[model samples]
Target: MAQDIITIFHGPQHPGITGNMSVELDLLGETIKRAETHVGYLHRGFEKMIERRTVLQAFTIVCRICVPEPDPNEENFARGVEELMGLEVPEKAKWLRTMVLEMARLQAQMLWFAGQGGSLGHYISPQWAVADRDLILDLFEELTGGRVYHMYITPGGVRRDLPEGFLGRLGHFLDYLESRLPEYDNMLLRNPVFLERARGVGIIDPATAREYGVVGPNLRACGFMNDIRKDEPYEMYGEVDFIVPTETSGDVYGRAMVRRAEIEQSISILRQIIRRMPAEKEIMAVLPKNHRKWEVPKGDTLVKTESARGEYSYYMVGDGTDKLRRVQVKGPSAVHAITLLEEMLVDSQLSDVAMIMNSLGTNPPEIER
Candidate 1:
């Protein structure tokens, strides 16, 4: 029997679709037979835009490209520029950078938790998850003066060192979050609605994940032990001790469980960074008076960091000029586009389309740019 193929566009602004990009889905009844992704709905000239701006100016703009997770871009850009300048970042700054990146990870995961739960039709869970996340953002507001897009981490070092008794306050917040993990378990993790909705949904197998170059929690959920923190160990990660969570299921539920456990790991990492961090940390470096013409020796550097979604890479090419010759960003959305969303949608119900795609944490802006 020849099934009728129905074409449906997922979203350009649909909250369920993650970011503002549409997907061309060919469906037979409720089953999606094929998916073609479109990305230009967002700002299309990100690379060209960066080349026009100064190195420091460009840093502020990079985060907007990938909203849900932005720190990795800051990290990669700062790291790339730093490598170009042969700048020696203070040990304290390195630990602090590691802490900041993980905090962003925790926040991104919080948002991911909410979005994933919502996608699977467990609406109440997102409320609880977002509520918990607001507290984390509150911490961000106090620390960086900005909750969502924190331009705290600059080229030389952070914008400023930890605030007065920042450690104690942060410690208290961490304690609060740590204590609330049990509630998340009761409310979302072990809740009947979530389990029923996510148990076997959006399943991505291990071999398929590896072949597609999946990274971070999604890949980890599929039983791959690939982690930039463990594998590369940048920003004082080598100094801390933490366990990378792994799951064998590779389903929606598996990723959820992995995310839940990973929160504990993030908390663990932050605590270690605080404990081992030096008291006299320099927030910024003394640079040349002329900020505009801040040129460094000629060199190109490729810096890759694992974000909430997966491995985010930045390729910085320099011609010994104040402005970067080229800055290229590579994110996990490609795999999400070609491998997961396209293949996973086939045979999946129309309703599950949003749920499945969002659960994968596909940020369209990353791919669109």
Candidate 2:
């Protein structure tokens, strides 16, 4: 006799889910026989909404494309517009943008730590990681006047100059964050529970990763040395020195380790930026005298940025109008959370579904956007 096949939804409301999304699973006992991703539970149609708004108006909302890491979306959108408008950002702005990006990466990784631990039935990691991440958000509030959705990075340049002694405060925060790394390792990375569950689970072959368009830590976890910041340098990335950490295991633990190393790298990059940042007051480029009527030239361009999750790209078009002719975002989660995730979930235990999802850095907003 054949065993009964059970069908169930794993998310869209379950706390273990990464975001507002669900996974449809067909299970034979506790093992998943097949899986399908379900999205659209978010504020959908970001690309369409962007086309209806002016260039400046669109800039404000792009950050919503990925909540955990918004700076990459901002950077991609700003760079795409700048390229089309032939606008040159000030050298100081480039350094500032790079600093913001690294900080964003660090905070997102902290959030990841929390999710990874929480998904595994460990609660202490969330408390520690969220508290530490809030420190970075505090700095962002001081720098950009908003904690979560910072519309600070704009086309041509950043919104404003750094506040007085902001770098000094940032340095102190880095020092504190550095001290906490060992504690994080003890709580999650070195934890025996995390190891048993994460190791050898959700393994993505190196060739499979490339074929599926995987980028960032997930790709690096598969032993690929590919990083957009290194391969395709933009902003102040070309000026910095850092190593792309990789793991040959290609499993959940490997992905976790890559992100952990990157957190240290992010701290190192921020220190370099603070020491080498140029002193210039010119943050914003000269726009048309009338702000609302500003128009970009008739052309199209694609800009890519290495976000905390992976490579994020923006393909933009201008028809010589205040509103963009077209704007489409190609975020890493689009591939990571949908097809790749569905495939990875099959043949895995139902209990590991959320664990695998968090390991992939899946974000529903990015998928829906």
Candidate 3:
């Protein structure tokens, strides 16, 4: 037997950045010969957890799929349940949900900045990025009551209405972020070091990207403009005007530009939502008399939504009972784990591991669970 090549487990605790997960690598010297993903660390049986809980209880757990960017989980579960129940959300609530999703997008992008920028020996940019991200989270706190894992976006509608003058605070934050964009350009985007390291590094062809089902910034990096938010126009996205930024290069730098450009677009979308939102409307739909007793007609549904990382889908099966019969979460991590991460790791420098993982935004919890 060709003594199964020497392999080493790289994470789940070591050099975090990617969170609690492990990467099995077969290595020859510095080259990665093969890679296998493994982690039951957070295998919380989230789907089964969903099965035992009420529709409302289940929504709260799905966010754990990607803690760094959780709103999309809420949106999917909420939308799925809404469709099954035939609940019609009010106009204002629709707009508010859009605003919440956009805000989550911005937050996740900021965290991505921290991951990407720090991976390649740059620190200030990520620090600034994360610090600024806190402002948006502050807004989240006022609106939804939690910072990191917000259990706000529920089926039928949001948890609560926006605070008084919330738009004014949101508008100010947007202006602040907009003004700082140029500074980011000056410090990081224009820096020669960042350019040389990022420009042509980690190139992914458009065909491969599509075939593997890449989503979010990585998909856009391949010059494909496919954002479910824009293409499908859920919530109030149809009412807003914003462009999906894309790049032909499909490298680290291309993703950086795509994310940076989208920051402005996100802010602009928020401004539009604030302006277009109806002044008065019911925020939450009439929910079941008792959440624990809530049951949907026996059937199945798959809800798809664009998360910051990529295409996030929630598949639910209702057994005509309060508890769900089955739930499956299919996120972009599937590609990032078994496919893209494997292909991207061979012969790559040790330094690029984190950057590559960050660029892909692989959420281990999502992939394993």
Off by over 4 Å in 2: none
Q: Write the per-residue lDDT of candidate 1 for residues 73-163, one digit (tens) a residue.
A: 8888888888888777877778778888998999888888788767766687688878978887887887788888988777877876677
The prediction achieving the highest TM-score against the true structure is: 2
Identify the candidate with maximal lDDT.
Answer: 2
Error of 3 at 292 (Å): 3.3
TM per candidate comes to: 0.95, 0.98, 0.94
Q: Candidate 1: lDDT of 159?
A: 79
The C-alpha lDDT values of all candidates are 0.82, 0.90, 0.83
Model 1 weakest 10-residue run by lDDT: 281-290
User: Taking the tens digit of each residue's C-alpha lDDT, what string does model 2 give over 3-122?
Assistant: 999999987876554569998999999999999888899857887898888888899999998989999999999999999988998899999999999999999999999988888889
Error of 3 at 178 (Å): 0.7
lDDT for each residue of candidate 3 in 157-273, tens digit (9 for 90 to 100): 887887899999999999998999899888888889888878777788899998988888899999999999887778887878999999999988898899989988998898888
| Candidate ranking (TM-score, best to worst) | 2, 1, 3
Residue 53 lDDT (model 3) = 83
lDDT of 1 at 65: 76
In the order shown, the candidates' Cα RMSDs to the true structure are: 1.7, 1.0, 2.5
